[model samples]
Target: MLNHYRIMLVLCSSVLTLVGCTNEKAFERTQVEGVVTLDGAPVEQGVITFIPAGKGATAGANIESGKFVIPKEKGPSPGDYRVEIDSSVPTGNKILDTDGETMVDEYANAIPPKFNRLTELKVTLKNGNNQHLFDLEKE
Candidate 1:
């Protein structure tokens, strides 16, 4: 019984050491929120992504009723970010009968290609909470 206890104690100590060693430093992030509009109209449904201008995690949020909020925990650390917005709608129309009535989703770039695929909008975030409103135009 004593021998078994010694083995168990060693095993437990090893497991505890491994668990403690797994800790990694977590960085502070700025909370971000904003409204997205295109041509003076709110983007009804979509997603907004912020890619770090230099080196950092890419963060995103779902757009609902033209609003998006990125909590600090899930948002990127304070830095420059390029913004991209995209939205899609179901056309309720089939693509081709040859492919057994394949349905196609109608995708719209409400913010314009220049704002998404060719993003030109840049935002700077400071520590803590940050709020910014975006008014985009295709032209």
Candidate 2:
């Protein structure tokens, strides 16, 4: 009788352990993809960041040829976020580096402040995939 009870207890413990080890994430994340365009032209290369409005993880992705994709594994949790997109263009000039060791190409942000520093862009990410298109205009 004691041996049977011990076996039952071991089985129950095993089941509990398995349940605890099941594939479950502590926080949920959703995939996000989008395109970034400036004045009707695709951005060649840039970076897009999502700053959570509330308590959540911030996510970002690289924009390549006007497309950006944040996979579900590295996506942000469902919430409101402030979007920031930035791209730089070479000024066709070279200047001395701050390190005072080499010359560096001068570059400037192609996107306006309205899309980054003083951004007016906002997005709400849901439980599923999210897609967005940003057509920014220069002021």
Candidate 3:
């Protein structure tokens, strides 16, 4: 009985030590949120992406809206990205008017327009919350 008790105590201590070591370090967390706009108007739909700052950084995507949010589990990092917006698609349609009057009817394409440089804003994230309001305009 004495020997069995000693073995159980040793096992319990080892388990406790392993569990404590597992939680030795905690990862820092950061968050980012902001609104995206163009020409003082809200951009309907767009895609927002994050590229990690340092070498071999990870990437994430958040769709475009009036607002966007990104969670940084790996703490704060630096990176460069190009934000883009999809403009309304262009559809080719022609209509004619009668009685000496000319009328033309047009429709937007089923596909949304794609802007390559809408989200091309450079930003940095440090220790806390980082917010950005992007107001893009056509050149």
Best by TM-score: 2
RMSD of 3: 9.4
- State which candidate has the highest lDDT: 2
lDDT tens per residue, model 1, 25-137: 66557799989887888888999999899877789999998899999889987988898888776655546545667665554444567778888989998898899898888
As for candidate 1, its clashing pairs are: none
State the displacement of the C-alpha of residue 106, model 1, in Å, after optimal TM-score superposition.
3.3
Q: Compared with the true structure, what per-residue lDDT tens digits does model 3 show for residues 1-139?
A: 9999999999999999988766534544566678867677766665555554353244344445567777776433443333443444335675565554785665452222333432355566555787777666656
What lDDT would candidate 3 get against the real structure? 0.56
- Candidate 3 — which residues are off by over 4 angstroms? 1-6, 17-29, 74-120
lDDT of 1 at 21: 79
Better TM-score candidate (2, 3): 2
TM-score of each: 0.74, 0.83, 0.54
Q: What is the lDDT of residue 71 in candidate 2?
A: 97
CA lDDT of each prediction against the hidden true structure: 0.83, 0.92, 0.56
| Pairs that collide, model 2 | none
Quick one: how many clashes does candidate 2 have? 0
